[model samples]
Target: MRRDDRENWRRVSRRRFIRLTGATLSLAPFIPLHASAAAKARIGVLKFGTVSWELDTITHHGFDRENGVELDITYFAGEDATNVAMLAGDLDIIVTDWLWVSRQRAAGEDITLIPYSSAVGAIMVKEASPIRAVTDLTGRKIGVAGGPIDKSWLLLQAFCQRDHGIDLAAQNDIVFGAPPLISEKAMQGELDAVLNFWHFCARLEARGFRRLIGTNDAAMALGAKGPVSALGYVFHEDWARANPQAIEGFARASAQAKKLLATSDAEWLRLAPIVKAEGTELEKLRDRYREGIPTRPVAEEEADAAKLYLVLAQVGGQRLVGQSPEMAPGTFWEGMPK
Candidate 1:
């Protein structure tokens, strides 16, 4: 009763312990070894902005999750509103031109830029218009989107003055208005030529408007060796430095999204509604977007930006470039993944 029964009980207990241990080990693969704590990045973007396209792709494909970050997006009605939100510490990131980032940095904000898109507007005319060249714009009524100090407008002026020896600002009847308004006026034949943002230009081009000159070409004429990203992701330098892993993950996720968009026509097809384009308009938008993806090194981009900055400053004056005649140091975030 003592020895044999005790032996049997010990043997059964040992078998039960082994079975439970095996079960636990088998279930371990399904359980999280460590709780997920992905970094949170609050980004502000315009409601209908192109940046939304990439953000959508990143989220839809789980690129952000794959890179160990979580994106919290806020949509704004206007670029100024997004900028204000960023300044008020409501947002950690926003899409804007590096020039604006430079201005902010110069004013002690310590913001930095990461390249986004190089696509810019073009000088477009109706199919039958006689405006064959930049010089032909003389005495013509030109509708300029983004106002007098728009980087595109200033680049156009700089190009004309440098290459054609004509001051376009003085020679042409310039009409400043919103991008959609300018496009509408151009469509109605009220404007002899229109310089609108790339998306508007794509829409106009789909409707048979001819591109007289692209701002990229103008940028080249003004001394940029390659495509220069006019717009980029802007964020506070202190915030980026404190969250290096999150920022780097974001950069990689962004790059992966761009690569997907660049190579996959299927992605563009999915983005058609967001882009508000179709057929020729969609094709133009897709092609232009692919063309704008940054290919050169950061140093090269910064160098070209410096040269373009001088040209912009010459035309846009202190109002456009702010207190800094040159791009502020560390305007482009060097921590970006290669």
Candidate 2:
């Protein structure tokens, strides 16, 4: 058989194996002792990185069980693919960066933000590098994993333009490549800086990279209050509309999970390994988990994330609010289910 055919067969076989043996996959340990059995709910999780904590909890903790749903998950590369899958109906829901939704809305794509997570991605530089601060980023090359239209890249650019008067679009050398390659290049001194989320940045810092700036720092610098800063969840509008009960069940589970995470730091820490199983060290995992996990259902953070996208839309020559001030502001996270 051809290579593509072989790969396709492998995928089919793998999924079939899961479907056949998933019942025996042993949910005994993951599910809470008190969880009640429920119906099945298949959800797609785009494997962006370490943000699987919420999903892990949903699947493992019997949240789905209690709510009459069995969570079936599909993981993908990043927000782009996840959003595409959502649009194509291959995925019913997706957890991705809020900016993806904003861009989708700007393009008239039918997606909705279900809930907001917290901010975490930050800029990393070698500790010995002469660039000590964000202001020093002038005239230096910066690497972002996602390309130009990425929300983080745009936000970083806005920060530079608004604060230092340096238009990154015009002056800075911003490169897009795989995070591993970027991290390796940054380590070899081939690049002055690289942008990374907490997981990778922690590894960089452990290897002696200094944090030049982050969304949190920029938020403080900009005096942002109730502004959205980073990642969140999205789902197909039609799917959400049609499967209101399923959606409500998922949301209810999420609220419970968020509540548990907020009140119990110890429990949250114990659950970190599930999210960080892809080789993140304990300390780094703890740090990344703590950065935003505790802030689930934080209204101010969600609002800030929506506004961040609106601002990016403005910068990209798109009006998020449709040129009506009252209509625009409310359009963002306006009809979101509480």
Candidate 3:
């Protein structure tokens, strides 16, 4: 997004939202584009992820209203659905990867990335399991979330190559599946180890799984100098230009929500009903939040994100995003409201 496009969005009053809803007063499922001139932009979110947590916070606390926009959040079951919705013009912004934006721009899709969430993943196993390290898993069946081309999985391969002198893809019986399956297989003893995303890694830990390698160490293993942001908000350049305030408000309110998460564990408990998360999951959530989320929205070390990109480009290959060595230029958006 351009600097000149970062105008202030007009905040929509609760009265206007009610009026727009016409007595039923619903907040989701059907937010009209011209509703109340509050700079509406539909946001598609995954059932899980940092944006889901933050967006839920923003809406429940009216942070979006304070920041000057009306957010209509649509929940998607998978990342592919979210990306597809963005391409179909059904969603204005969705939490995705810069890598995907690189691929889309290569296809002439006009997608651009803005910083969103960053956390480290892990290769975890049962506490009592004989698998004490990534190197020990030479013949083990490892469950990998997001599959072979997953950025984290690619990073794991990079780590193995640099540190262990072996090909992870060629060595283990890698099962590519969802995050939940990582826990399920690990618990069932069907998988000796599993590589899960940060949030899910926390859940696996809460369930008594031990980390063979954590995110920071995993980054080192993958050849990054430090922690980096792999996920972000993806947008259409044309839509972002036309409704600058909408884009700015989303990022601004999200920053506020990130700050809220950093400051209050009580606030974390408050989000359970909204995100439909509860119990032990809350503790796991706290673990991920405390150790995974950054003090600022952008990673403290900018070089970290670049090192991550290099690993993904070199290791992820054509399977991940179809772009290699060169990511699309101007993918990062610097138009957040001051």
Candidate 4:
């Protein structure tokens, strides 16, 4: 062949090799190999509790890196504040209270429930106090972090009213307190009781505080057949739509984490360090996890709707506005791997 013809053949061969390489790469793990090659996104989370674990892991471990994407996370105090930040467009994705998703939707804000994990709150009181039963809470002053829209407090009241025929709001004074203040106030005996989630309640229990009730128990009492829950992941609607791959990537990582927790005691032991509460009270943390992490996301529409409406209605003195209490939208996704 002439020199010019040989050179033309080599150029064609190189172009074909490049095309085959691109096709081969595309057929591999789309996330683990592709997303990280793209761009990094931020995931916002609420810092108050153990519920932030999945996003926290994603943020720290490059939830994006495993899937080929980059992730950054910011933590906030409570769901209300987190929602405010989400609405202001400060977050790419977020994990927040599932109940707040509906509350935000009812108020005409658009957000979705990503439903990554599950947890329940417990009612804590000092062991030395005379409060041995939920009924004993009737006249005691109770402290909760968020005002009325908080699901646990509302569920507590519903369980009390529905099961025992006691009107909690009319019977006990419900005070909204900051997260850090609950332990101090409860220990000081200034507050008769407080509703707490995860290790905070565990801390109280470790400190000789008696738990008159757990949110899970209350959920069963309210006829929740499976896991009655106080916690899950919430994401902004627009943010999730634009960042679907990010959501999918993070969800895949979280499902893997859940499977790890479920199958391996070793993994649980490993996580025990990170999720465990610090201080001498740490034994309480072990006990709390031993009870089990539900990890099942609630349905967006049916299962969680009434719960949200009931809680929010009790808060605002309205029943989801124009919508009937019996019907509402489910905002969460299903089909995460077990």
Candidate 5:
């Protein structure tokens, strides 16, 4: 042991410590900046193929964390399961329609909704089929999503009754089934026409099927015309009130993501795998996204809702429309962050 040896050892130790500190500092920037500051929001998503791709956009592009929302996303089989989760307090937010929230509020649930999606479903007939107009559907074999209580089905009936002097539920031999199969059956010529969710309908249309009527068109035929985003992001009122900033953050992030998707084909192509979409289905999906994604929340009363009550009352009856001539105040929360 010598003094010089001890000095050399001290220098080595100091050099090792400095290198270790530098390495740690290099990794520090990777930590999510808003992980601590952002509020956590547990969101339920219904996996409707590419119909909910905007949600995928938010996640794929890191919009959630960027906008200060710590997202806890859970996917359900469909809207019904998501609704159950929302009612059971298992979720903070869900992708749903305003009608569901309004119905729950009518039944004394403390539920409210914000705009999320709109103009995303349609009725389709084979491209070569003879069904050219609403009047042409009589005596045809048709397929529909949901059932007699299905909103799209009921909307068709109401629209026909009001404008065409007919009832779709009665004029056609309507078979109720799942959405995916409806498209398949139509492609196979098993049905004359099908009322389906937007993405599937668009896919079919892209493959040479024709839309006899889109959901927005159905709304219009019922005298409720405009680009009303019927679908919404729903939350229990108390959860929304307690986490206003988080809610606003999430809303803004969603808006940013939606705009990104609508404007940038490259973004859509990048995120197409989220829905397992490829090839023509992928392009069709992009078209559907372009058709449905609203540039802004339909905030104007006329365009935002467009005699929305008639659609609700016709589809869901008293159980959904309730006694209110219009949506109860606060039922439709336009509380997005400015």
Candidate 6:
């Protein structure tokens, strides 16, 4: 080959390489990045909380990644620890009741809540007990979980007073204790009736205890239009505003996980070990969890919460509701980021 021809070929090759590189660079804006490159959110959760069920489902199904967020989970053994972590800025999110968020907001903390579950406690008694009516509970020993200001117990008191003309706190022998302790004592027949959390109530139901009255029933009797969420995913409003994508993505992933759990029995079976339930207990847990999933609009939930807040204030006094006689504005976060 001639030297001139070889030089011409080398120039053409270099020109072709530069043109291809420029074309590739032009297409760079159109190429999608991997999901791992998305935003990250740090969430604190109770080690054995029901929230874990939904979170596990999200992780297993890659819902977070699909929604453009990566979840960084930290587990705590107690609710107080998780709350502390959240308040101290160690976590971006935590699950808690909206009442607490309202109290915090009333104190000027600027936190807000998104609905998680409407499940609440119930007045439970053994299947063979003769406590067929609220009147029958008069003079009976009642074990209450979450102390005197517990929302369920306070609601029950208001319900009884209005519907049956009975003041439960004065008429009954009230015993306050932790949820697990109260549940165990109730199982051992140490109390005539027990007002306990929803999960404990489900366990008692599986063990043949009868739900004398659910908190939902009392709420309805007291004028709630539908189920009211007692608990939700709470976070700082400032943080939510700053990381809009992360916050909204987490909410969407959470909702998808709830939908999956609501429909798939196989998902529940996969969660059996974590739930520590089997047979009837598993079924009870599954059904109760499904029932707890929040489906109502945020406006409806906030409206119901406002009504219930007044009821709680009447029964619980300033100690329970803090300085707020009414639920603080922005207690229930409206959907999506602004």
Candidate 5 wrong stretches, greater than 4 Å: 1-35, 48-52, 296-298, 301-306, 319-326
CA lDDT of each prediction against the hidden true structure: 0.90, 0.65, 0.76, 0.64, 0.76, 0.92
Give the lDDT of residue 213 in candidate 4. Answer: 87
State each model's C-alpha RMSD to the native: 4.4, 13.4, 12.4, 5.5, 5.1, 3.4
TM-score of each: 0.90, 0.72, 0.82, 0.74, 0.84, 0.91
Best by TM-score: 6
Scored against the true structure, residue 94 in model 4 reaches a CA lDDT of 65
What is the C-alpha local distance difference test score of candidate 1? 0.90
Looking at model 1, which ten-residue stretch has the lowest summed lDDT? 31-40
List where candidate 4 sits over 4 angstroms from the true fold: 1-32, 35-39, 47-52, 59-63, 107-110, 236-242, 261-280, 286-292, 295-308, 311-316, 319-327, 334-338
lDDT measured at residue 124 in model 6 versus the true structure, 0 to 100: 96
Candidate 5 per-residue lDDT, tens place, 1-338, comes to: 89999999999999999999999999989986676788889988876545357777787788888888888888777777888998999999887776667668767888877676666677788788888998988899989876667666677677787888887777779898988788888888999888888778767867899888877777766665466676778887788789976798888888888788778988867876676677887888787777776555445533446366666675667765667656655567756565
Model 4 Cα shift for residue 16 (angstroms): 18
TM match of model 1 to true structure? 0.90
TM-score-sorted candidate list, best first:
6, 1, 5, 3, 4, 2
Q: How many backbone clashes does candidate 2 have?
A: 10
**Residues 1-338, candidate 6, lDDT per residue (tens digit)?**
89999999999999999999999999888777743367889999999888898999999999999988999999999999998898899999999987889999998898898899998889999999999988899999999999889898889999999999999999989999989999999999999999999999999999999899999999989989999999999999899889888899999999999999999999999999999999999999899999999998889989999999999998898998888999999999875542
Ranking by lDDT: 6, 1, 5, 3, 2, 4
